[model samples]
Target: MSIQDIVFVTGNANKLKEVKMILSSESSKFNLINEPLDLEEIQDVDLKSIAMAKCKQASEILGPNRPVFVEDTALVFDEFNGLPGAYIKWFVKSMGLAKIVQMLDSFDNKDAKAITTIVYADGKGEFHVFQGITEGTIVSSRGPTTFGWDSIFQPKESTNGQTYAEMAKEDKNLISQRGRAFAQLKTFLAAESM
Candidate 1:
């Protein structure tokens, strides 16, 4: 089935927009839908499990006819031993990015990576999970054009010492965790359709 043939489920408008843009660039014939799922917070310790919980919730809400997709992502720092792995949202809400960077400053290790796990369910209890990862380091200062942790998080081996946020949207999309996951999803969808 083409993207146009599938109904995309999402509660976040920003994420929905980004996903739609990525899908459209790959195939204009695909359809994008923004259906919010009644998802609940999971008390799980692993990001993958949390993502599956969200997907299961969405699948239940969507019934048996529609397929729902849910994604959970985390930022793991080498020094912190993955302190914020599955609690990234909590960390963001409690300490914010600047404080997190300040806390990281005390450590000599700045190596980090962003991992995203995407769960897709067809409302029949059957699901698929896809993971995408991007390795990088945390920078000390913020950049002019980046948002969120974009200004402070620099990907490893990046040219000009730029963060994901500093790169153009197209460029970032090519290397981002979401990008990698979506690429895999596209391939899956294509194969399934055939």
Candidate 2:
């Protein structure tokens, strides 16, 4: 199948890298164009809404004729009842990853949820959202402390009990929230293109 060009609007380098890695494949239908834009995100409890808003902004800036997608990620703590859902970027920015993990030190339940929402605009005022969630627990920083909160969140299904940072890139992507969301996007794009 011929690859189709699609704009991926994101300014975060780390995020962009992961998206590229996760979506790259021989059978991949999309040729993701990295178009970094300073799109303003809306403060909302719904993850899909925020992603849709960002996609809309990107579609507007890139032109309504161009197909585009935008992603929003969230780290939600069960103890805090999702205190930093969409505001996780700020939480990590202000408190740092270590301190954020320490916040759950007092609580017995260290459960948390990692979420990724990918919003797509068909360049005709139509919007589609694909979301993925990984259920996990918060632990002390346990691996290479490079990416945001990667060292602290451990997926419950992981047999080795390794954090995202501890796992190989391919292994992590196999179960990552972003990877799952992108999988949905890939499937949708494949069917839509056909």
Candidate 3:
């Protein structure tokens, strides 16, 4: 196949769907594809560093001089002092969202933020990073969606007052951290294509 306009390296179907939706809404001639590539993530507190490292590693492994992008996300809780932060995956695996909300129940402050960083490396290895952050608080897990940390997150800026898991997919795309990041990416790609 011809080189895709961009290839997003990720395993999460939810993310892929959100990004595709964002890109398609542009009505621009840009192609985006996702192929899950597991890479050893460098331990870091910075989401940008991790995303850049993954993008670099993925491009190196793929080795065809194509535009490749990868993203990393962190859910930061003020009560835990951002304890999990970039290490959220392991934290989620061990404690799950229920435990996180439960642990926060005793605290007076429940302020939290969700961050997503996307690093894109061109065939020449030049990288550009886009980030999105949503300020929210932890809520009791609700909804049927299984994506990590969604059910427990209640974004403060949303007018619907629903957790990410509870909103329709398009609604989530409008306000999600990943959605915002991809929105920026879409703009960047459009400008670059000109």
Candidate 4:
């Protein structure tokens, strides 16, 4: 697919902004369509399934020519057997990050990670899936610069045990789950354009 023929479908403005910034920095030649293709949120599901479902929904709305991209991310904690893996959104909205931290306070393991899967479909049965993961541990307090659960999640071997929110934008973009997934997408698009 050509760069001018791509569109990103999402409802989160923050995520859109971050994606735009990343693409811009790479001089990525693609258009971003901010239209929100509605998808019902299914509880207690796997990340890949959620991504595929969203991709299908967006493709149906976009018709048979235009391509649409959708992503679903989940925070999986090793200590809790990946509790809230696919339910991170509801958990965050219902309990907030603070309460989640409190809930994990007594767990024997703090190892956690974020898994992001992006699905791009051309509405013609042609689709691609890209995934990114950031290995980290759960922190007790929120960081000043991070958004969402950023302040409460620290990457492994991080300096001062800081989370993505505590790291600079450049640094975060280098190792973030979204960053990794987008990088893979960028590479795929670049190759396809060749």
Top candidate on lDDT is 2
Candidate 2 deviant stretches above 4 angstroms: 26-28
Write the residue-wise lDDT of candidate 4 on 135-194 in tens digits: 998887657723578788898846677787788777887888888899998888777657
lDDT of 1: 0.75
Question: lDDT tens string, model 3, 18-124?
Answer: 67887786645557777799888998877888888898888888884888899898998887776578887787789887887887878999889999999988777
Task: Write the residue-wise lDDT of candidate 2 on 19-99 in tens digits.
Answer: 888877724666789998999988898899899888888988999988899999999999888778989889888988888
- What is the overall TM-score of model 4 with all chains considered together? 0.91
Span of ten consecutive residues with least summed lDDT in model 3? 1-10
Worst 10 residues of 2 by lDDT: 22-31
Residue-pair clashes per prediction, in order, are 5, 0, 0, 2
Worst 10 residues of 4 by lDDT: 23-32
Of 1 and 4, the candidate ahead on TM-score is 4
Taken over the whole model, the C-alpha lDDT of each candidate is 0.75, 0.88, 0.83, 0.79
> Can you list the residue pairs that collide in candidate 1?
1-193, 3-31, 4-30, 4-31, 136-156
Looking at candidate 3, what is the lDDT of residue 101? 82
- Cα lDDT over the full model 3: 0.83
Which ranges in model 1 have alpha carbons more than 4 Å from their true place?
A: 1-5, 26-29, 144-147
